[model samples]
Target: MVSISRRTFVTATVAALAAPARGARAQEGSPRAGGRLSFVIQPEPTTLVCFNTTEGPAIQASTKVVEGLLTYDFELNPKPQLATAWSVSEDGLQYRFELRRNVKWHDGQPFRAADVVYSIGLLKSAHPRGRTTFANLLEAGAVDEHTVVLKLSKPAPYLLYALAAGESPIVPRHIYDGKGDPLQNPNNRAPIGTGPFVFKEWVLGNYVGYVRNPNYWDSPKPYLDALLVRVIPDGAARAVAFETGELDLGGSTPVSPLDLERFRSLPHLGQETRGYEYSPTLYGLEFNLDHPILKSPQVRKAIAHAVDPAVVLNVAWYGLGERTVSIVSPTLKRFYNAKVPTYSYDPKAAAKLLDEAGFPLRGRWRFALTHDFQPFGENFKRSGEALKSALAAVGIDVTVRGQDFPSYLKRVYTDRDYDFTFHPFTNMFDPTVGLQRFFTSDNYRKGVAFTNASHYSNPEVDQLFAQIAVESDATRRRALIDRFQEVVADELPVLPLMLSKPVTVYNRRVVGHTIDSAGVQGNFAEVWLRG
Candidate 1:
């Protein structure tokens, strides 16, 4: 256990720790035309809540309509979008982004740095990722109509990647409307943008359609005359549609690994199978540190010991997941402290640890676990049942609960009313953004009151995380990360379980697609129809 930095456990479960502050691949291809590509995706995202948004889908849809300062290339490299190029201040406290001349908002207004500056102003000071990314430039300033400078209060290393996500999606300044509820902005229903597509029509419950931008800065691009996004929640229904040619692309409903061969084996669907490259996303059980029974390190360790992540890989996950040692995955290989304990199957050890922790037997403690319903969407349903049996052998009692994804997220994540739940997180290109959401106190799970679920707080760990965030040198920062991991192991904070192998399905009619580790970003600019 010495490998465990023995620090005050993350000091908290994660939702409140100071982070290394946050943190590319490229795919290239030619544009093609004359084909319609569509794929099935689990209906997840809907509104741009800004501070409280929880997904990537709607943003993905919105991005096509709203251009950002810096965009990603096929390999995930930072390329200029609205901002053609930029430079940084010598002190590393300010960043200047120069807008691409002649760009315009979908509404026909000339694109300007003032819009960028205004959009960033909406980022709540409490938003962890936003605050951390812009930590250097505590705020933004307009140098001119086209040039905006971001001045930092410190040297934040992960700022660029943070800007890459929610922080940089430029919103219409007028659309925000200064209302208290930005999510209800009229813009969300038919938002404007400066991309290849313009606001066409949004038919709630059916589809959102966008027509090609006639005034697009770049002509001969976005070959599709129109783009349509249909909302179909059923995975099978979506897949059937993709198989028939109802869509030019599918964004949800992952292709199962088992059916990969069979699905691809069928004609006209192989090309549609693809996903964002593997990034640092993780899915595992979140312990309610508030639970009296789970408070002991032995209990957390026992639960980790009892669950067989390998069985999860082979069964529910279909051998599609990579077992995780620390919370950090291989996509985030650098932050990983390999010295942490690995996942192991030891029912006997699990029971022993619980017994030592004062539980008379497995069934001794009663508990509840919950998740949104989606045909075993949590992936750990059966595995969790198996653990129930194993824990019963030692005297712990358990119950599993199911709710719709929306309600589950609202209660568990937004409201913090959950006891424990099956939490599966999508990967992010930036470690700071992804991990910070889970660890920062500003975030909550469930609909009840919010508290840092881990009940973990340590002044020393917090201090270290602060230093890690601002440290400009690579070597010192990494060393601090190692220290963070050790602290997690000691606290047994959020037990690291398993990482899943991503499965993507596509149609053969599609071409010029590349997947990067961020899980789904790459070559969008170069993706052309090949039918």
Candidate 2:
């Protein structure tokens, strides 16, 4: 945790890893069967309210219990889901969606536009987080019982992609109508979903399991009779659990060098141990422009200029990450702006900016950082120390304030207490939604569209962001994006750092499992056991 939030950062930065060499030999896909998938499910997010508040793995585990309106494929395209098809108006203001008929909630209630309306309403009215994630979509009014029509104040090109994310999961209002609190009730412990699996039971902090939904809408999904999720926190312990037959998978477990070596030393090389990016996650110094000292464009630029991301990639991560400049991963080439300047080892230049900004002495200000048990905590600490010394030489003071995740989230977003937070943004297929959400003034102190934590904004940047959201043309949209980033770079609302890599570990028995870039989507539907 950093000075920004005290409860939870609400977003996870664990995603991406250095991809295999371009010409690396290809391996065939493997699918395993049965033999329950056991791994860590953070006890922190057991209740619906807690998970909804922080939006962490606890609710992620619930993805098995609820289904989104749409799903995104590896390419970030909208895949089929509760909705069969959708349409956008020529003026870029109105959108209409055709619902997939004959779907049912876990309680066997028919799902219609009313359920969609109710879920969105609940998230905005009560859910502590993600209210902004659905901001644009909420602008619409349902056209009929089965059709939802959205009329945006402005054009938004990525609305479809945004709806595909789990943050926008649809809940059945019928079941939650009078169930007391939507969170913390017995219902969460025994939830229901239209997805492949339905909640069966939770053994407190030990495990929360699921069984295949016999009446599931998706064909050939949830391949197993039961999915067993066990809570194992220690990274090494999870890996060891897999090696010794105590676990079937490694959820949220870092595949460290020791684990990799252990897997390599085992009987199977390609078969037993698997490594890849499970999701698209990004980790960087989420700066607060709201703080006066950091508000200086020169100061923010200097920090970005001084940051040595490659060092984090090569040393802190044992060469597991990519030293990337674009916030959108290379996998998202369409949105990735290659022209963005890359941060190098430039402590001198960083100092120059501070001096040029009239802080001529050196190190003008200091900030605090709180600590979370992310794999990069040590890395950020080392980098922060070096930055402190570097900025001090040039008349700046950087104080590192470290806090835990829970505390960090509450303070930063809820209380607006952070000066700078080292955190990651969760990945969604649509970069526009992610970018616009964080930059907008309305989203500040709340949702994706909220004002910057740095409390910074510009009319021009705002205009460009709105334009890009509705500009469906690829070339034009990208051009608008570049302009937006240029303004951001000039203002230093956010200091863009490195693209992240999700370093994941799994057992040999787990097959057909490819972690998406966000590391969201356990995708248990396609996962099976082998041998």
lDDT of 2 by residue, 1-531 (tens): 101121322211112212222122134343434556664554435553222544556655776677776655445545456776666666656666777788877678888887777776676666544444455554545677788776666655666565533556677777777778776566666776677777777777577777877777655556677877677656667666767777655444344555665676765322221222223556566667767667677877777776676665565554545665655555565666667655566778887786777666523443333322222446666555554554555455567665665665666766766667556654345555455556666456542222355565677877886677667676888898877656665565665555555444566566555533324344467666665
Q: Which ten residues in a row have the lowest lDDT in candidate 2?
A: 9-18
Summarize candidate 1's per-residue lDDT along 1-531 as a digit string, tens digits: 001121221111122221110221122244455444343335645652233353556655665677666544324445455666566555556667767788777777887777888777665342434555565567788888888888778877666555543335777676664765676677766778777777677667677677777788866656666666667766566656766667545543354454555566677775332344324456666776766776677888887787777665666666666877776665555466779665477878887787777765334553434322223454556656655565565556666556665665565546555556545554355445556445544444344322245545556566666777777666788888777767766677676667655554556555543432222332133345654
Error of 1 at 448 (Å): 7.5
- Best by the TM-score measure: 1
Looking at candidate 1, the ten consecutive residues that score lowest on lDDT are 1-10
TM-score of 2: 0.79
Candidate 1 C-alpha error for residue 161, in Å: 0.8
lDDT of 2: 0.59
Q: What is the C-alpha lDDT of each candidate?
A: 0.58, 0.59
